[model samples]
Target: MENGTNTQSEGKDPSGFLSKIIGNPVMVKLNSGVVYKGKYFTRELQSVDGYMNIALEKTEEYVDGTKRRSYGDAFVRGNNVMYISADS
Candidate 1:
């Protein structure tokens, strides 16, 4: 490319969707059937990465729909994450 510039078409990006949900409540489920409900993604998240690794504040853990415990801040590895749902 001539002046170090080029143009190409790419697909839709999900980063915008992720960014929009910052400071909102969400429920995150892990592959092990554990669920974590908390305030979702933000600067303190530490690493909301490509694998979906998550960090949260004011987190509550749930097991089989039963509240188990709470954490002031929580970190979960992305590999175990099943899905993340935003609160309505």
Candidate 2:
């Protein structure tokens, strides 16, 4: 997990498929302590450029220590992801 580095090698499952069971909408925990809820999309198991692609649709919410914040639809790339978890 390099800072601002999106260099993923080939033959690697960049989507972290094993973390999600059936490609359902899950809570993805990012390195920034932000929990993003979105559906899993296609992954590149062998790509040097684009490692992963998630069609994430984030929501607007308010935290305890902060005011309301908003998020929108995104075509999130691979390097932006840290880890994913299914929302059970």
Candidate 3:
């Protein structure tokens, strides 16, 4: 049972998933609860070091679901990233 599940999951390439959304707008949320929205940059995602470099066009620092601050273009490290999702 476990082997079957592992094979099924292994068949799905995470990089393939990321490639599909490259160049599209994406939202990145960090472990710190900060969110960044911008066009997904594919080049940085290829980094083997696990450092996510986002071409930040907008950012929202959240504190208990409330936005505390906003900002423009910036780059974020991958270690802090919690998840990346496609932004409408």
The true-versus-predicted C-alpha distance at residue 71 of model 2, in Å, is 3.8
User: What TM-score does each of the candidates earn?
Assistant: 0.78, 0.45, 0.59
Better structure of 1 and 3 per lDDT? 1
Candidate 2: tens digits of C-alpha lDDT, residues 1-88: 4586655652265344444344465665555555566544434212323444455555432244343555665454557667655666
Count clashing residue pairs in model 2: 0
For 1-88, candidate 1 gives per-residue lDDT tens digits of 2477543421133355567688899888999999999996578554676777788889999999999999999988889998888876
Q: What's the ranking of the predictions by TM-score, best on top?
A: 1, 3, 2
Rate residue 33 of model 3 by lDDT.
79
- Alpha-carbon lDDT, every model: 0.80, 0.50, 0.65
Model 3 per-residue lDDT tens digits across residues 1-88: 2654565655344565566787777777889877766765456555524354455545555566677777665577778888888887
C-alpha lDDT of residue 24 in model 2: 60
Query: What lDDT is reached at residue 69 by model 3?
Result: 74
TM-score of candidate 1 on Cα atoms, chains taken together: 0.78
lDDT of 1 at 6: 42
Best by lDDT: 1
Candidate 1 all-Cα RMSD? 7.1
